[model samples]
Target: MTSTILNPYLEGNFAPVPDEVSVGDLPVTGTLPRELNGRYLRVGPNPTGPAATDVNHHWFAAHGMVHGVRLRDGRAEWYRNRFVQGDAPNHSPNTNILAHGGRLLALVEGGRPPVSIAPDLNRMATWDCDGALRGGVTAHPKIDPASGELHSVTYLLRPGSEHLRYVVIDATGKATHTAELPVPGVPLVHDMALTDTRVVVLDLPVTLSMAAAARVASGTPESGGEFPMRWTEEHPSRVGVLPRGGTAEQLRWFDAPRCYVFHVLNAYDNPDGSITMDVCRYDTVFRDEYRGPADVLPALARWTIDPARGTVSEQIMSDHSVEWPRIGPELVGRPHRYGWFGGIGADGLHLSDDVNRVRGGSLEPGPLVKFDTTTGEISTHHFGIGRVTQEPAFVPRPGAEAEDDGWILSVVHDAATDHSELVVLDAADVEADPIARVHLPRRVPFGFHGNWIADNDIGE
Candidate 1:
């Protein structure tokens, strides 16, 4: 008899919650901010009973479950968690959740469209932008702060496919325009970068591999080779800079080394007609083991691309390990002084062999780090041991003057209690004690992305 070894993603804080919960009047540990009248919603993988224990279950295949905390008038009003149901029972958008065009959406990569969720996190349905979205959208779409238009880059899910599109949706939730392009072997374009004048497309080395797919097709509890993508040596890692409304032929390309980027902190246009993109860059990911991301960790690096000279320069900003970087709300595709990242430390480098291990180790967050771009200064706030934090979203205070004048909100999980709480800290001073903490009724499994949706934006 062959033994079934569980995937590391199915254990510890990475595990899923069984029931959909709704609780009212969640207890607050400190005073709540009156200016904050919104909900913080986050989505992640939550597979049901048998799938969670299945040896072939990949972390990316689980269904999407969103956990939300509603706050209004200096009170923690309610807490709710709901699944983002897809067309089929098994398919769900388990990657990222955000508010766009006055609607809440759950998003995933690989050519899947967005799933809509109500404000109360009750129901979910596949949203096709009134039948205008001809194809799937990316998980990380950059919404222009000034114009409120959403920009995205979409790719076909299959390998060796040449289909890629640059989709633009207007402020009213309508598909405005799409620029189609033909490219080499289909790369897993996880995220995109947006500047004022153009959009940055990442055509990286990691592409859908038939070899990897064949291994996954065997359907066994093997030690490795469970994922469906691999790093392709033939596919040259490059950056394609496309003008906002320009077509495929107008794209300017710059070649780069073999690397992968799952997220972009921010990108902006420099004065010299070049682009500056700061990203969490991994040297190489999905090369060998297909279980999760790279066996190595990602470093904070800035890539300066000069289209005129056909050159790309790399600068390592911080050697310390960090992920889930966030800047101010209005700084998307714009230059900003400060950025926040969840400190990963060293424990996040690889998966542990012990599936039963828990209690504040192995990929759990360490501290909330603040990086000053102008001064090269770093500040961090450690939540002590056994307490880990998720992605920190920076919300500017009402009538805020300075760029950093705001609050940082994130879901913090405690290993001892197996519980989670929404912690709010001053963006200007994250090292200080939290200004408010909204204790949740249940545990929030380690999730991917979340955002604070204000009432006025949703027309509440």
Candidate 2:
């Protein structure tokens, strides 16, 4: 038997900060007001079918704070307190969370629930796609800071069926609008992004030919959508931008290269009048069709969505294979920093050939990268190799503080024991060690995305 117990390389004393920025660990609250009890009947695996753990086991993951909006005068305020409201009992198989509109929307991938496709593509726990399945919310809800409105995206599935549909929720936690983004193929919404006026979805449509479906049903990797179907390279996915109000109208749709299975980090307005977005992708398929070994360099593709032309253009950067690029102080001109986990290729981190073979291997946990598109200058601080650092949240300093630098709150994972720690770092210097490390009592499953939720305004 082998063990995985790795520790993050520390520069200064790994001590606690007396007054450092911190968040508390509290159970789901505010769920009572809605007259909702945190209980769900989980579906288990077929007992006569196989001697396996419950296949369709589902449970809530995380709750998000509700965004406060003033409808009378259009006054807007985003939460700053460190508490999560409601109960997120189910973990979205392929969804991310974001604050949008004057509310929060949980956008989810719309498609078939995982099943035992083959020996390699093992049966997904029955609980995998649990939730309000008819309309499973997955994508993160994004808030329009200026208007205080929120937006969310999700896919709807009928009980015991695979017919997928798309739905968007308004700021009030209600699925206000619905639509069917139909194609001959099955499309999944992995990640979504939002600007002040529009929302963009990174969709991957798998064209599982009838021939392929037969093979998967018979149990084989030689089947199920081509190993790498001719993904719409030039236009692999589609972006849907919906207006905040006005009947949740869709502003427009733009075609772009396939996003594969990646999530959009951030989308914000640029001073130069452009919309910037960051994404991570896995361009490989494993022998077991279900799980892909992390392999290759996840490219940090930059797109500038322009309303004038109603299209997105790629932004030239010094390199590719970067994962989780967020807008930060370095992108002050851009108003958002893109950040994500994964290692940088060419760096010493991608040491083992076996690792390189998997989709996300080949590189060490990468340095947090901040690129100023306005000047084309990039600042990077590699947070050591062994620590699997996930997405980062940029916290702006209080009034009269230097806007050039802010605090970055990131989840640091100890790859060895799989333990995670909440780490605070100076936004300006990535190389400088963490300002604080709030060790968690338990290991948090690797999550796709997260954001800050201030607690005070929830009662108001």
Candidate 3:
């Protein structure tokens, strides 16, 4: 199959839309805030057909697709797009889509498990929360804005599996706790960092490449590709911590410096004992190019974990070029000054030489920044020039009180009319312009993480 004409992630704005529409009242331009009712979900990876160009075709292994809208009271209501039905039938739950406790999950980390959608986007099944999850689950789970508990660390790819799993779930959704942590190899533990009392884990140095799983068990082509993972200078890049409900021998690793962190813009518990996180760092990931990801560019570090002098102190705060980071779900696990990101444009931007092959590179992601971690100021909004932006979702305002008082929900993407909008900004004047935009009839390709559930928290 290795020939979708040199693939670049299916072409264009990362193309892959084959129909799943269901529209209604969606077409606003301004005003949409009667305390902004509910639903604004987003989940990416959309490859329901054709994708098998070999080398394991990856844009993070496509096929999840979910793009909601629905606001209320102030209007801008319907607009949907489905396809998340996992548990076989091509299971693809993309990456992230939240709403915990009241259900609505749709994550994807190591492979299959969380899929219970239906706030009108359908697809109801495959949730292991009852069996307390046995296979996979971390699409960035960490919902504990004061014990709404949903934390997760889940990891499983089989083949000698040296351990990883640490769920929590409480706050009425159940799955009280689960532990197992021994690791040394199966790495690629995507994202994790929640603190009120700990659970940080990042084991890094990318792992899992048993010669790409023996070249997909000898069927070789580009040899079972699709991120079988690899970037092991001999492993060991540590940063464990763990101790919220404790176990895994009470963890405490620390070490860190071989860089690679998918996302984690908040984490705290530092009075005098220390433990501050804030990440996006990526000095290396998946290694010197294996068809995709690792051209490098992800800065925004700030790790200071001194488990009694075991050590871990690095700082890079911001030199621009950031990636999906948000705060204010009441600042999950505490302490935050202000944070939001997605900026990355520096010139005509480009990212599809068959989708980031990187030679003559381009991934121009421009504006929507906003960081003032207590006086290092930087605020951006620039949604002009073939625009592209995703991952904002802050939404608070409803009798709010300082700490970035509300609304930032983003979804941009308008490569000169390829379409996709849902803007909204105003999280304390993010350089103004766009207190609302919501027009999305199609073209929402690039995606990975979203949430804004209100409606009194769905469920009923």
Candidate 4:
């Protein structure tokens, strides 16, 4: 067996911890907000045992592990870490964690159902939304702030399947609607955008490639072994728009350039019969090979879909590479001006070719970025060298009036000390130092999305 120490994904902060831990009353560097009471929970991939050299593991193929910190009464409380229990063969739920229908679900994009977990991180049964879900659910489901409904476009990787399912779960956590939409190939729809009146679906050039899958099965050295999908020039890149309450027959497909979007900032309907969406656009992904970091970087871009003309217009919003775009929860499916993201800073410490050659080598997420859509200005908070940050979740302060009036919560990993800290910064002034830094017992590996579940929001 080849030691995982040579695999970039299993080394450093990306390495999986050996055991789960529970601690209380963690130490803090600054004052915690008295009004803020919630659990800051994050989920990511953590392999169960030693990584297999012959298995061709992808960074995303590991088991799911969750880390959480409780905050209340202006003080740091408990911190707990646990593995998400599920029935899937791999049982890796490392993607996004969110609350819906009063239940907390750990979600992965495809292949497996979501696993419900308790507020204290105890694993529950696998959730199928009362068997309403026909296939795997998307990790990025848009919850309408006004209607309290959840919407998603889910796909199944089963052979001989050529359709995607559009699902809507009611506020009470019941699957109300499911529609099958036909497509040419099994394209990866990692995320989608929602507006007041429509749902935006992305069908990019990256699709399941049998040739790539065969190469991986044969253990070809150049094959990005874990994921069998790859970018193909033959695939037609397009975007589809569907009515909020309508079916596949009413869906209109619009042509888009050859690019990919991993996450959308927000989308809203325009009075002129057009829709505007902000997203982190990558020039290409899963292209030549998927062994390591993408050769292309993603930047914020605005896409305007004109249904009448059947065309989509795109304009770059920023030049810097960024992802995990987020806005206030209240602004979902509505117009918003401010957005936040995590990206590589100006220092460019992790982008070198050498780093990109190894899997998960570029794990250092450099800075937290704030984008002002109203004025086209970009502000950032750089955490300096050797300190990496994860996705920033915006927590609105009590009685907050402005959209940006909140605290940005992120888990920062310090390589110098091999420890992690929950850093909180006022969203209004992101360039300033963090308002509070809650120390953690161990490093939280690079992971996907997380949320701040308020005390009042957790189910009793």
Please state the error at residue 166 of candidate 1 in Å: 0.8
| Candidate 1 pairs with clashing backbones | none
Compared with the true structure, what per-residue lDDT tens digits does model 1 show for residues 160-182?
67968888898889888888877
TM-score of candidate 2 to 2 decimals: 0.58
What lDDT does each candidate get?
0.81, 0.40, 0.78, 0.81
Model 4 residue runs over 4 Å out of place are 1-5, 50-55, 214-225, 345-363
For each predicted model, how many residue pairs clash, with residues at least 3 apart or on different chains? 0, 69, 6, 0
Error of 4 at 200 (Å): 0.6
lDDT of 2 at 391: 57
Residue 37 in candidate 4 has what lDDT? Answer: 89
Q: Which lDDT value does model 2 have at 278?
A: 58
Q: Give the lDDT of residue 151 in candidate 1.
A: 92
- TM-scores of the models, in the order given: 0.93, 0.58, 0.32, 0.93
Q: Which rank order by lDDT, best down to worst?
A: 1, 4, 3, 2
Please write out the lDDT profile of model 4 over residues 1-460, one tens digit for every residue.
8554456666677678878999999999988888778899999877765443423556776678899999989888889999887765656578899998888889997656788889988656688887766377898999999898899897776445698888899998998898988987788888998999999998988787787667757866655337766787899889999999668998899998669888899999999989999988877777743643454666688999999999999988776667788999999989999999887633423223353533343334668888898898888888767886868999998889999999999998888999999999999999998899999999898877899988776654
Minimal lDDT window, size 10, model 2 = 37-46
| Candidate 2 per-residue C-alpha lDDT over 109-227 given as tens digits, one digit per residue, 9 for 90 to 100 | 44322211111111213222223234554444454554444444544422233333444444444455455443334444445677655566555553333444455356553432222
Candidate 3 per-residue lDDT, tens place, 339-454, comes to 98887662312222233433223344567888888787888888887786857989888778898998898888888889888888889988888877989888788667888888
